[model samples]
Target: MLYILFMIGLIWLGWKLIVFAIKATWGIAKVLLYIVCFPIILIGLVLGGLIYIALPILVVAGIIALLCGE
Candidate 1:
């Protein structure tokens, strides 16, 4: 009776601890993943922005080159 209740309590405690650990591990994994991927994402964004900014200038230069027969 009492022993059974104690066993149930222990089981409940273990289950709660497992759940907490899993949640904590999942949160850490997400943060680490974001940290690892952020730089690559940032680099891609920077390159994309540079192309967006430079493409018009390049087109104008090409037009000038055509006019100059170069």
Candidate 2:
């Protein structure tokens, strides 16, 4: 009975750790996407002669940033 309880406790702890790891990884991924990837993508779009598309995207991003400002 004691062994069974110990095993269950270990399983629960392991599951919680996995959940925490996933949440942490996702948060880091989002930060990288916004800080690093977004500007590179916008620059590429403009340099590739897609200014028409890039301009509207930039405007919408600006509006979102303004509205969502902390």
Candidate 3:
């Protein structure tokens, strides 16, 4: 009985740790996407003469940034 309880506790702790790790990884990925990838892609779109599409994307990103707040 004691061993079963111990096993349950260990499993719960492992699950919580995995959830935390996933959250942290997602946050890092978002930061990299916003800081690095977003600007490069935006510039590529403008240089490629896709201003029509790029303008909408830029507007949406700006709104998201404002809503999310730093």
Best of the candidates, lDDT: 3
Q: Candidate 2's residue-wise lDDT over 7-68, tens digit each?
A: 99999999999999999999999999989998889999999999898889889999999999
Clash count, one per candidate = 0, 0, 0
Better of 1 and 2 by TM-score: 2
* TM-scores for every predicted model: 0.54, 0.90, 0.77
Poorest 10 consecutive residues by lDDT, candidate 2: 33-42
Candidate 1 lDDT at 45 equals: 60
Name the regions of candidate 3 deviating beyond 4 angstroms: 67-70
lDDT of 2: 0.95
Please give the RMSD to the true structure for each candidate, in Å.
15.9, 1.0, 1.9
Alpha-carbon lDDT, every model: 0.77, 0.95, 0.97
For candidate 1, the C-alpha RMSD (Å) to the true structure equals 15.9
Clashes of 1: 0
- Give me the displacement of residue 9 in model 1, in angstroms: 0.2
What is candidate 2's TM-score against the reference?
0.90
TM-score of 3: 0.77
Q: lDDT by residue for model 3 over 16-63, one digit each (tens)?
A: 999999999999999999899999999999999999999999999999
